[model samples]
Target: VLFPGVSIDECEAFTLAFRQLSLSGLADCQVVGVGAVRGEVVGIGGRRDVEQTFAETTRPDVVLVPGGIGVDRTAHDEALLSWLRHVEPSCQWMAASSTGTVVVAAAGLLADRPAATHWLAGAKLAEFGSAASPERIVEVGHVVTCHGRISAMDVALLMILRLTNRQIAEQVRIDLERAHEQAAVARPSWWKRAVALVRPAPRGPVRPRNEQLDTSDWVEMELTAEPSSTTPNGDF
Candidate 1:
């Protein structure tokens, strides 16, 4: 995964999780960075310090870049854009999250594709000739994208689904507690029944065993033990 610049959320969302689940095992296939700027940016520390100006890294089967302030700045960077251009042809698959789509779009890679990006930058996506949608995850050909932060998780699952099968994706969904929020692939009208068969129905709410407490049923009273005064009342 080549993050144009370091972004902690993007690293956590894709890189950390990919390390946990990828076939190459945790230590073998590591997440590398190609830093666009010099200064440190919080949690996104020294991953792969690309001190030299943007140049294509090793050819990757999958290239992923997630959105952040990094995307906003990297869009106009000539060298970074040049590096992306070099990698585009060789990458088997490419994906972006949130505003990172802006960088991808600016690279002319998402043209003629249905892309997803932050609602705030929807127009920016269009400016590059990509069809931007409000959908959580949009996959046009080998390119995948998500519109915002929460959809980062969805983009990861979709990548897994594409590489594996629906069954594995379903299992991962259950394990991640993401089945309820998993984005659905549009199916043919006839296949809708098949989709229904695979997907469980929406869960019904759990009912409480007890009824509401009625405040009116409760009583307020004031009582005094006046009789306890006994002989004391007669005496001074």
Candidate 2:
């Protein structure tokens, strides 16, 4: 994964999904985060440490470029663009998410192809000669583009399906979802707990009537009822 001004949410989505695949024994894979330098790269949500610098990084089967506020500056980086151009031929799959599509497009990798990006960046993506798509995941040849940060998990699952099989992918998805649900139940947010405490208990189920009333009896009773003068309306 390329960490140039990365969106931590997107990064985590991809990494966590891939990690689940590995942890579930569905696939054997290693996800490495790379950057221009060796240490930590401050990103949108948080900072992440890169395992390798661009120079030390080996050829990866898959390359992921994540988008963030730093993309404006990273998009203009000739070194990163040059590096991406160099890696394209060797990479089996290339992916970008959100504004990262702009960086890939800037690298001249998305030319004349349809690519997915954040809705707001469609016009910007078109500036690089690629047709921008609103689809959550767009697969054109070996390149995959995700529309937004949340779509990162979709891309990861797609990769798993492609690399492994539908069965494994489905298993991974179920496992991740189960884990997420368990986590939510295990440690709910303060607001959720507060709401639960103040919430009224559910009402008991209604008891069945011992005897059913006839519709004719109800109509007769309504017609025979006396009107109350205390109601202020003489007609009742």
List candidate 2 segments past 4 Å from native: 2-4, 187-236
Query: Candidate 1: global Cα-lDDT?
Result: 0.57
Worst 10 residues of 1 by lDDT: 214-223
Q: Which candidate number would show the highest lDDT if scored against the true structure?
A: 2
- Give all TM-scores, in the order shown: 0.60, 0.75
lDDT per residue (tens digit) for residues 57-126 in model 2: 7587778888887666788888788878988888777889888899899899988887888887877777
Evaluate model 2: give its TM-score: 0.75
Scored by TM-score, the top model is: 2
**What stretches of model 1 exceed 4 Å from their correct place?**
1-6, 23-28, 36-56, 70-72, 165-236
Kindly report which residue pairs in candidate 2 clash with one another.
Answer: none
